[model samples]
Target: MIVFLAALLMILGLIGRMVYLMVFDAEYYQKKAEDLHERERKIKAARGEIVDTNGTVLATNRTVCTISVIHSQIKEPEVVIKKLSKCLGMEEAEVRKRVEKVSSMERIKTNVDKETGDKIREMELAGVKVDEDFKRYYPYNELASKVIGFTGGDNQGIIGLEVRYEDYLKGSNGRILTTTDARGIELEGVAEDRVEPVAGKTLQISMDYNIQMYAQQMAEKVMEEKQADKVAILLMNPQNGEILAMVNVPEFDLNEPFTLNQDQEISEKSKEALNQMWRNGCINDTYEPGSTFKIITASACLEERVVSLSDTFSCPGYRIVEDRKIRCHKVGGHGAETFVQGIQNSCNPVFIDIGLRLGTGRFCDYFEQFGLLGKTGVDLPGEAATIMHKEENIGQVELATMSFGQSFQVTPIQMAATVSALINGGKRVTPHFGVRILDKDKETVRELKYDDGKHIVSEETSRTMQALLESVVSEGSGKNAKIEGYHIGGKTATSQTLPRSANKYISSFIGFAPAGNPQILGMCVIYNPQGVYYGGTIAAPVIRDIFDNIFPYLGIEKDVEMQYTN
Candidate 1:
């Protein structure tokens, strides 16, 4: 009787458990069964567009396709290989290798043209799969390649602004889920489930397309004419610090960033060469500013009252500073001249004397004050910091060289930003490119903000410096930069590279327009030009030619009263 009772209890417990599973756990088990037959594939989201301030598209995406193969679904291996190889223009052997691989899915090729992908899709060969994807396209090919950067096979940012703002530039990927049978074939009469991908936000930058084109044209012309190693041009608004254009000559094609732009054997092209080609010399590299640095020295001196514009000094070609004899550019010198003439002549002796008057303590103080000694905090990547002698290590000789823009190194962007400060009402602005971010509907998602700038010098000193730089273009070394009816102001630099004996020089010029109330500021740097490598001669003229075209296009009217004088 006891055995029979135990058997009955066991049967009753089994019945209760079956009822619970059928009723309470039915949904969960059903989902698990459905999941076993479901196959999921990913859909790539389209990357955002990059536009200029004028709404001109600089970097955009083109529809492409990714060709993949499902190993289990491929029944006719030889037929699949033949069709895929012919359609994809790939080797049959290669297609066969991937088709025979024991994997869920294998990618044959990505970035295939849409037309070709559509052709493959129409074949409806069981194993072959084509999905829409995006490939970054630069309409201008090589324009601003380094700054806009490029993406990798995974569609992730590689460098430049693309990588810098990756979060905003990349989008969320979606999925395509389909029901499949045991044979890995799509189940009949079943509809596929697709989750649409979300596209990235549009990035708007301060770069002006027209200005950039003109600047690039001028840079190419100068580089070809001078046979220089390279040339870089940067343009910005001194008042607001918006970089209008940045040109690095011999720019690599954004589409073919891996290929070297120079004439060299494929095997000889090293990674370093590619890096150098992509490098934006204007911010990534540093050099002695030479006479252009004189702008900083003069501004500091004037602010400190160490020297007045009318203060007179004698320059018999050189100055003796702590046993070191520093020679001026003009060996015969200007004999006796006021401080204004000294600046125009770029006299080393006059600046050295004034630097001595300011003293080492004051000179270092100004160096720190001028925003030199640090990065410009530009939006671009790989910005180099100014290389300087430590304040405590600076001596009479170091101070003298620093005064005339030597014995230290600063990136071109730093020089441009600091000079902008000296001329733009004493506020040191951060040089940047990003302007705003927008959604697909063109609504403002976020307006980018940068440092509003710190007050470095007084407004009075800024005005005085502006006038002094205007004299540099009007009557001094930078005369070649003068436009016929524009009140242009600038400083010229001819700095020698290291080892002194190498004799290689970088010719550069930093200039602004309508000097009284500065607007556009630009700098042209020509590295290692052949003969006639003076900044005033080669570099200054490049800016003049660019401004001549860009100024008119930008609707900057000429100053009717400002006349050119020989």
Candidate 2:
């Protein structure tokens, strides 16, 4: 009787403790259980777009179906592998290994085309699943390849404008939480939890497709004809520093950038080829400005009042500065000539005279003022600065050679920007490619941007330089660059490669069309060609080709003779 009474009391004590625990921790336990059974979901945000100034799509994202398999749900591994290999067009062994390794987890397919996705959905194979995601597409393919750039496997920009503006291009991502079944399907009628996605802003660029195509076609043709190692062509608006077209050959296909962006693991042959293709030579590679730099020299001389257009100099083939000889293009001499004639003929001795007149002090100062000695800060990737030797104390020889565009290295963009100032009312305009940013809904997020130009030289000096350069094509070394009705001004360059050890040469030409008003400024560069590699022979014809194709597109009235010839 006493044992029975003790047992009854113990049972009553245990029941009392249970009642207390349930009353105190009931809500906490219930919440924990609910959390354990909850489902997680990802909400994808839209990527930013890249477009042209006129709303033409250069880069965009498209919806694609992703296929995955739940290994645990696949009852017959070998049978499933066989069936999957057939549907996916994959090797049977590959599918078998995939299924064997992770039977219970989801295995993602590489990518599924529209037909494949439809077939898989129709088959409704057990454990198969599909999801939507964004994939980048370049509608223009190889067109403007270097300028537009491309992305990597993770949907991130790896190079060019895409990489440079990744933050702005990749918008905010969203997330969600919900209940799901064992099959990982969302539970019916479940409100769950969610975070809204914010789409990325779209970007509009200054590039014109018509102009880009023309320039690219010409660059391809010239590269082929010259059998040149590399060719880069650039077109810009001198008035506002707006880039219309920029192309480099051999070009890449954005659709097939995989091989293009490979690392060292790729073949050495592929690495070499890809390295050349990726240069964006116009902005990344530096070359001696050659006689093209004479414009800067003449401009500085005029600005400093060191020399006048009427000043006359006697050229004897070469000039001596600190015992270093600077030779003129004319082997014998240009003889006695006015500054105007000296410039028209691109006489090296005359420019050497101008540099001496400016002296070391004023020459270096103007060099900096003209935007040489630094990067142009263009809106592109991999910009190289003008490589000037450490000669803060410029000697006579250095100054003289520099006057004729030697003893220093400058990028094509910097050279073009500096020349643009020579004719654009003497304003130092900053160069750019992107015009604006937009959204998926076709709304403008950012407007066109321009680099604030600073007036560096007198308007009169600019006009005089314009006339002198115009005379070059009309009656001097750049005669081949002339387009009849349109007054074009340009300078030919054949800069010897610096570091002397390489024994390489960079042939170049820089010019602007409609010299009277100045619409387009252009440049063409061929690096280390086989033979006949003077700027006149290698670069001037490229300028002519660009003008030939792009002039009509710009609504430029053709010369009467050109119309008749057509």
The lDDT of each candidate is 0.89, 0.79
Candidate 1 residue lDDT tens string, 151-231: 887888888889988899898999999998766677879999999999999999999998998889889998999999999
Q: Give the per-residue lDDT digits (tens) of candidate 2, residues 1-566.
A: 99999999999999988887688877887776666556444555667888876778889887666666666556666667777788888888877777777533455574467577777778767666665556788998988888888877557887788887788887887766767565545467988688877877887788988888878888888778778877888899988888999888888888787574343478878868776676688888887878898888999999889898789999999988877787887899989999988987789989888888888877878888887877888988789888886767567888888889888888888989999988888888888987777667777766756667678788888887788888888888888898867778898988777567987788888888777668899999887777787888779988987897788888777443211100
Q: Can you give the lDDT of residue 376 in candidate 1?
A: 90
Per-candidate TM equals 0.91, 0.86
- Which ten residues in a row are the worst by lDDT in model 2? 557-566
The candidate that wins on lDDT is 1
Best-performing candidate as measured by TM-score: 1
